[model samples]
Target: IMAVPGPSLFTLRDTSQKVVRYHHNRLVASPQTANAPPGGLQISVVPNQFMDPSHFPIIMGINGGTRCLSCGTSAQPTLMLEVSTHHWGVRPRAF
Candidate 1:
């Protein structure tokens, strides 16, 4: 898991938000193969005030990217946010 340096109140003399705008969590997409399905990627981002159970905090975004917030709340945990992107298309036959 690749982590990006984010803003953290903890950095500011023992506070919270110990990972703001930092983690751009992403997953390496695999190369396409014959008759193979599409691949996907991952990302992370900061958490906004609004909370959506449909998309849990661990993955609070669309099917492509997520933003991790260094700023944490009593409700949200200060963990690295995550997301994924899926690419769909026809699989080519042998060359």
Candidate 2:
């Protein structure tokens, strides 16, 4: 999984190399991947909310090739976010 952060929210690229997004309380494939398959793949949904703010390292998202929010203990979490790219037709904000 690869995550590219934006202004407020971020876009998730799944193993299928398709962008994934959270909408209406569920995780769905984003139609942003060029020359990709239809509907991408059905990914297991996870709560798209932040953990305890006190967590030593909590990765909310990454911005402009910089670590926006710090996270930790993700050795093998059910869902993972990772990647780098400027999407939505806007340049990423400098950290």
Candidate 3:
């Protein structure tokens, strides 16, 4: 049984994009740190507007700038990962 091809799982564009990293919920398989551009940690596999509305919405991390929450209290397979390491930079502090 060796047939690996259902989109080969996914990791980039097709998967939209992501930078998963975790510690409390469990799911940080090798995330030392290097968010690429504006920093890292992303995870997307979307589409479910009010219980599926036609389609078009799978934005995981969109570059860490989108967490439109309404009420709160709902963690399922709960995996909306995003990370930052390499000493977690922010170059600006000499005090």
Best by lDDT: 2
Q: Rank the candidates by TM-score, best first.
A: 2, 3, 1
Using TM-score as the measure, the top candidate is: 2
Question: Between candidates 2 and 3, which one is better according to lDDT?
Answer: 2
* Per-residue lDDT of 10 in model 2: 42
lDDT of 1 by residue, 1-95 (tens): 32436422221111332222222554233344554433222233443323443433332332333233222334654544322222234321112
lDDT of 2 by residue, 11-93 (tens): 45767665755456455666665665544333322222333323232345432323333334544643345332335554323
Name model 1 segments beyond 4 Å from true.
1-26, 39-47, 51-79, 82-95
How many residue pairs clash per model?
15, 6, 9
Least lDDT summed over 10 consecutive residues: which range in candidate 3? 1-10
**Candidate numbers sorted by lDDT from highest down:** 2, 3, 1
lDDT of each: 0.32, 0.42, 0.32
